[model samples]
Target: MHATPAPPALDLPAIQALAAADMAAVDALIRRRLASDVVLVNQVAEHLVAAGGKRLRPMLLLLAARALGHRGPDAHQLAAVVEFIHTATLLHDDVVDESDLRRGRKTANALFGNAASVLVGDFLYSRSFQLMVELDRLPVMRILADTTNAIAEGEVLQLLHVRNPDTDEPAYLKVIERKTAVLFAAATRLGALLAGAGEATQQRLHDYGLALGYAFQIADDVLDYSADEAALGKHLGDDLAEGKATLPLIHAMLHSDAATRDRLRAIVEAGEVEAMPEVLAAIEATGGLAYSRRRADDYADAAERALDGLDDNNAVAALRGLARYAVRRDR
Candidate 1:
């Protein structure tokens, strides 16, 4: 049997060209900071780091800072800090969801066991705080500290919503807003803050990141249903398998008739894919995927709008490209 070909890379030439040097510095900082004397910690951290992701969050911070004419070295430290926080969450998230795959590779929890993954995740969190302290900027620390706390709350809220077929679009959006977008907002705003940008500019960047996060996450959820497993770099139906009623299911439930909705609820509650074909069919019939994508596009539009008053530069253009890519990416 032949191996399936990997999907084409996500288009990010503009972001790449603009952020290449900063990203390299971020990567170097990541490698330097992730080092641990403990064998298990080093092993687990290295494994996940090597697994490789687009590092988009840190890239956003770097771009936002440069776009605002920030020339400080502190931005680099903060960018690495944001990436560490993101990786820590992925570690814990996989453990909580019992996820076995991510980014087309075995998840840390899957490869290293839940105990190791969780502990290493804790290590990353602590290390990130240590980096935060290095900056000695109270406001930046406060934003990250509050953002992390909100993310925890979002995780708990999502836990409550699991297997709950009645989870509404508003409830789901709130969860993503806290769990994901808050951090994105912090990342972008921190850049503006580092540059000593005025309150208005900082707020605009914050709004841009917040809207971009929503678009990015909603598009991600849609991919769970609409993308091929190889292209998605994870199993299709993973969300359904975990019994999470994300926006696709939420929209499908609302649009479905009583009988179809009842069936969908059963699948959600049972957390099984035995009825996946039927559930997907119902979602397709009711235009769930289309609805979700439309919602994502709306957020992307909001992100672009947030950039309207920013001075024109390559970094600003890259930010716009990133907003477009948020909704358009295949993985």
Candidate 2:
């Protein structure tokens, strides 16, 4: 019986530095392909791109490719394709969520209206497919096409759960698996595919991405309850206002007394933003945040374990750091 060795210390800046060159290329490609003759399309697409998120998904692709010994222009094109697909989803997501802010800036839908945002999102999607066609790889095309379909299914699945207090952990996990984890899997798997890695290695990378996505989304749910609004880049109770029954709230409800459970249910069902104080109190009392954090830690550990057989290198090290950072990030 041997204990699993601990992962190395997480250094996010170091990880970013390692991927900095590749990411710059991806960014440039994204900007170049984002241009459209229609002024509104350009405005909406540029708005989201300029907001400047961590670009973690495409970075995952680049890092995975490097870990598998690939340094080619094809990775850059595919990385940009991943970004465009991700950005398109975000655009549509804001419209569906009716969100006003993202990354501390007004959402595209907020600035340009839902119609413009949706149409531009379509443009990005089509552009991504065009880039994929240029790559001339059927496998790449299949993976992304399937991933986008799964994301659409995830959106509808989440819509069904929204404002429904009956949503449980299993159902929530299903939503995240499709909405988030599948794309993460696609990104890393594509990395492996591009590098001509074996089936086993590709499977490992896919598993790593899947687990990381779970950890990241779970940690994000916890942050919605406990993180500073400024650092979180959104209102504290945005999930609650969206009537989303995320892990913390679900956990709190499961462990609370009938009265408290009913209160939580009402809050979720009614999108009761004002009930955040009470919800936080219940979560604290029930150790819901602690429970959710523990779940995130488990998934992060799985992500690290999935990388065990990969050759040790700067890229692999960064992947490990990313897994830890997924659960530990402030925003």
Candidate 3:
């Protein structure tokens, strides 16, 4: 009879609240995990950790656990473990992407070089494994192991898709699922798992994570077309320059007439994003960016749907809000 309250705006206050909720335990775990015999381990770990990461993966874990009425300490430890996995991926990603700037700071690979970044990513991965073993959770271990493997596979898949403008939705989804979705799924699943949620609830958490991850990544691709360099922390149309056939580009090429399509192909194949204005105009004309945003909205809707059975609470509502924020964020 009455409408349920929508989640609050993901403004600074809310983001800060989420950060505060996650800060203490994840920070401690990072410090504990970064310790090593080699000095470069400490240096590389500190550089990336101190480089002002958003820590979204950990926030999702902690909040999802809180949403499910979990107050136990294990959630925090697992949340930190999720972040370590994410950070490791990021370090490796910078090297693979061969770019500079993350969150407005010089990329770890750019500052420290590829070898340091790659080796430190290995350190982070090993540290995460050690922490998971400490948790003594077979399910958790299985989830992460599968997730990291999926990520690695996704990276290669994306590289394969690069410079090829024919990448369609299915191809794009496969790349994002491995490169992004599994980690999100694993993090939220860990929360539900730690909460001792029923099988149904655990599945819902996985669904939410998967959908949210798709929304998050599709939005990022849209940002590459629309975002300003200063705010987005990367060059506009970087995906195009890198020959990444994300949804917008893939969709545009799929729908374009042969001449227009050829022009688009040349842009991607050329590997010169200096023509971003032209690319942006073409994508906008074909409504590719709008189409991408709409698909992201679809995934966000699915994410909210997965929360249908969660107990009525602010945290639950916040989780729904997060689904929207993933698509709506400008930066």
lDDT top scorer: 2
* Worst 10-residue lDDT window, candidate 3: 7-16
Give one digit per residue, the lDDT tens place, for model 2 in 132-214.
99999998999999999999999999999999999999999999999898889899999999999999999999999999999
Candidate 3 lDDT tens digits, 222-315: 9988887788877777787788878988888888888988988888887768877777777888899999999999999999999986776767
Q: Runs in model 2 with CA error above 4 Å?
A: 1-10
Find the 10 residues in a row with the least total lDDT in model 2: 3-12
1 against 3, candidate with superior TM-score: 1
lDDT of 1 by residue, 152-243 (tens): 99999999999999999999999999889999999999999999999999999999999999999999999989898888999899999999
Of 1 and 2, the candidate ahead on TM-score is 2
TM-score of 1: 0.96
Instruction: Give the Å shift of residue 266 in candidate 2.
Output: 1.3
Top-TM-score candidate index? 2
List where candidate 1 sits over 4 angstroms from the true fold. Answer: 1-11
* Clashing residue pairs in candidate 3 (N, C-alpha, C atoms within 3 angstroms): none
lDDT of 2: 0.91
Model 3 regions more than 4 Å off: 1-12
Candidate 2 pairs with clashing backbones: none
- Candidate lDDT (C-alpha), each: 0.91, 0.91, 0.84
